[model samples]
Target chain A: MISQIAFVLVLAAAIYFIQKRFGRIRKNINLGKNRDFKDQVDKRLNNVLLVAFGQKKMFKRLIPAVLHLMIYVGFLVINLEVLEFMIDGFAGTHRIFAPFLGGFYTILMNVFEFLAIAVLVSCVFFLLRRNITKVPRFFNAEMKGWPRLDGNLILFTEIILMIAILTMNATDQLLQPISDHYPTTGELFFSSLLMPLFAGLNESTLIVIERFAWWFHIVGILGFTIYITYSKHLHIILAFPNTYFAKVEPKGHVNNMPVVTNEVKSMLGLVSAESSAPPTEPGRFGAKDINDLTWNNLLAAYTCTECGRCTSECPANITGKKLSPRKIMMDTRDRLEDVGNSLEKGGPGLNDGKSLLGDYITKEEINACTNCNACVEACPVLINPLEIITELRRYVAMEESGSPASWNSMYQNIETNFAPWKFSPSDRFNWAEEKK
Target chain B: MNIVTMAEFAAKGESPEILFWVGCAGSFDDRYKRVTRAFASILNSLDVKFAVLGTEETCTGDPARRAGNEFLFQMQAMNNIQVLNGYGIKKIVTACPHCFNTLKNEYPELGGNYEVIHHSTFLQQLIDSGRLKFEGGAYKGKKITYHDSCFLGRANDVYEAPRALLIALDADLIEMKRSRKTGLCCGAGGGQMFKEPENGKKDINVERTEEALETGASTIAVGCPFCMTMMSDGVKNKEREQDVKVKDIAELIAEAKGLS
Candidate 1:
């Protein structure tokens, strides 16, 4: 009875903290400008299924895809067993479903055991890839500190959690015959291999080990749930919504600024009858901080798992440029968190003086992007680093008139000559007269 | 070769079936001029009634928008839309993917809408309809590789049209390791052609050219004039200008049909 109350208290605490942190995150995301992604219901659902559920883009890198699939599938299926553990914790019953499920319970336990072993093996391989082999994507400049540690920590936790499950099952099998409280769950196929080691232990000692393993496994899971809210692993939950709201237009199409369009229409005397009134006060031209970006952009930043697939595939990054698309998303999330923290303390909020540009992301990094959409195409979750880059660039060009001199000259030539070059417009058809 | 203008078509109280949008590169760049003439020659031979926008045509503001000058972009877009709408243009074709993308995708929002087609797709249609035929072409069985223009391939999803045209030439179309949706940029997009690239280990064109050369194909086929200049400069940088040649798809098709 005492143990069950402790379990209830711990579970309630986990739920309370998870809710508080998630609420804070949602508030931070809402600080950005609103844009409607509610259109095209069918297409968005399809994207959620294919990109998020089906793991379609993950298959681009075949080896990692297969390994990740094992963990992803294993982890999800094992959580079903965790659900039973939760019920057993509340009711103080051992294998409560065993009586109702009867023979079917044995099959389910075997499948769960097989998946746990797969999870353990995959996690070990993942840890080696990150630490020993040191995959280039995992070791990029942005991945130096917490990002790297966070990755390895998640893998390590999964390995420990899997071992706890196997240990609990093995010890429980020995206690089933001696303790009336422990039900017969049949011999779990994978954990039975380890029963030989615990077979000679006294009944009291085996009961203690089983109970201890149960507590460790459930507590570890609760801790992981809270930790992910603060880690890059939040992608496991955000990927679905992020992929659902992904841009449905062609990859090359950059959205037109409606405010600029209005001003230009009035200037050219081309305004329609209804919109002919003077344009509203022109606000900031483009994104200088988190507030200027759309909510979807913020969602993307949080959804990014620092996979660096985008950076590895980026032409600018590959050619040793300062631009790393993965870094862009990471910086956005970091800055957003900073802003969120400041706001929570009743501070200056967005006006904390520092901004996304110049402070978090550099001018050289945004300039290096070719807008090739390679990063967009490469993203597994449909996050668009290119959109944020362009928005920042727009802020620099329009708000500050800080474009490079060569680009300013090109803009001038286009203004005067109706072309980027200084050549006359009358000469546009001269190529037709050239005798080839 | 005589090329008609939109003004001439309007003066005769008639309209051509298509308006050939001769972009800034096709108008000004010396190398790309030959591509313009080659496409024009093919159109003339096929007797497809087409009119050039000529001097009335202007930059589509693709560079301006990409460089983050939305004000300049909207201005250029509005001005061009006025002229295009004035002509009541129903269909348009261009050899430049950048111009095609802007005219097709961006212009519609500003009330400029038309059936915009890239020359690669335009030529493919001509071939598909049997309007253009080839006989024992110059590139017959020659291993030629096609570099995807980002604007054409990923921007608009027009990957198959260009490749289909190459196949019609009786040429062996070898693909680069990164082609179609995953194709690399030629270091000239997003207004990079107008300025130098940011500090990097190597230029993007040099990297892309190395991939093209790795295929061991003698000729590199391109659809965009920007890619043409970049790939040609890359081959020159590698000092393989004599051994390897960069030819636009239009020029290749023109040569295949004995039109140029």
Candidate 2:
């Protein structure tokens, strides 16, 4: 009776929270124009196959990826057995699961337990690798991003699931009498391995122990349920939607039609399309602050796992430029936190009064980006740091008259010589005339 | 003769089969003109009497506009549009991919639109129409690879046209590990051709040149003048200039089939 109730409570919580977050994600993706819908669908299917299933980008470092995938895949597989156990506990039936594959699920469950042991060994190796690499504190190297809260929540969730499996197995062995007609079947991989020592325990003693395991296992899963909703690890649900909505092509191609307008304008302050007054500078084409950016930009930052894969692939970061694409996403996420915290306390939004490119990031970061797609390409879940980076540069130059001195010099040369070099305009067709 | 975008030029009264605009690159750079002249020979051999805008061809102002110097770009584009209206010339073509992209895509925004074709695309079409035939001659058995220029490849999706031209000439096409749409920039897009590459691990063209050498191709084939110029400099800096050759697509085709 205790087990059945526990099953209903945990499963109910997981479903409810997952669906709630999924709704937020769906609303965010619908913000853009409908032109890219077919393209988005094609890319989404590709992302599910590549990023989610194949673990394509995760293999940049092999051993840890193997360890991580083991833990990941194990979590997926062992949970099936978990569901079966939960249903059996609630319904008062040992045969609640394993009916589908002609006794095949019984063998599959045992096989998976053996695999779970291997996954645990890989997790130990993963822990060692991170320690050696000094990438500790999974959220941020410093206290700049998602906070230690999210990592702890994820780690805690994993630990709960692991302990639940071990504790439930131990209790079952301790109270073999509860096994009764099923003989607490040595069919389980780990349980059978240790049953030799417990073969002589009394039925009553075994029954009491079974109760302890049943309680501990159910509570572990329920606690993790609540924490998942409020953490950066929410990508466990959002990553799918985020990847599905990722752009299939390059980001630099601007549409022939301009879409943004001055929202603050009233009356005849703004006439539409080639009016004699001439379109009052079109209110910041790139971005100045969080408000100027799209909702998907914020969503992209929120979905970041802080894997540092973005930083690794950034051309600017590699060349010792001040820009770390990982930090760009992390800073945006932090800005949301810092701003969100302030707003909760009735404070200002992100960037307050300063421009994002100049104050939050730097001119050094802006000029350093090669506008290469490396960071976007390397991102596992499709985060494009260059969009906001370039857009900010565009805003600073167009809106603020903040051209780089070198670029301006080249621009002047282009005006005079018809080429960027210091040649005379009279020489423009000299080579062709000489040829003819 | 006068220069304008393919769109505005098309409004002209002339019904010429082809209108050739020898871009400023063709006018100023020796190697660029060589490539253009070679391309011109191919077009003429196919019995096409193409008009050359000559001194009347004003700058497309792509560099100025992309560099955020909109005022200057407008001035140059308007001047060219006026000149083309005087030509009564409609059909248009360009050997320089940047000129081709500017005329076909950017000019529409400036109201100087017309039907524009890159020389490789025009030459390939002429070949497909069976209007031109190769004058067979001695060939070099060298490994050759093509570098896709940003304007030609990404901006306009013109990757296959140049490669198809090379294939017709029977040049060995060794694929770079990074080619097609994902091809790396030659550090020459967005008016960088007029400016130095002050960012990235190194100049992008130098990195691209390293990628080209990795292909072990004896010669690097180029469809865009900017890519050809940059890659040539890159090959020299890498100290493999003697081993790695850079040739324009037209030059390679002209030499291979002895069309020139």
lDDT of 2 by residue, B35-60 (tens): 87777776655567667765556577
| lDDT (tens digit, per residue) of candidate 2 on A319-433 | 4446688777766665655555565467664537654565567766666555445577677777777666655655665567665776677667666665555667766545534
Using Cα atoms, each model's DockQ against the true complex is 0.84, 0.20
Among these predictions, the greatest DockQ belongs to 1
Total backbone collisions, model 2 = 7
Worst 10 residues of 2 chain B by lDDT: B1-10
Q: What is the lDDT of residue A356 in candidate 2?
A: 53
Ten contiguous residues minimizing lDDT sum, candidate 1 chain A:
A274-283
Runs in model 2 with CA error above 4 Å? A1-186, A189-235, A248-252, A255-282, A306-320, A351-355, A372-374, A377-380, A410-432, B1-12, B16-31, B48-139, B150-168, B172-183, B199-201, B214-216
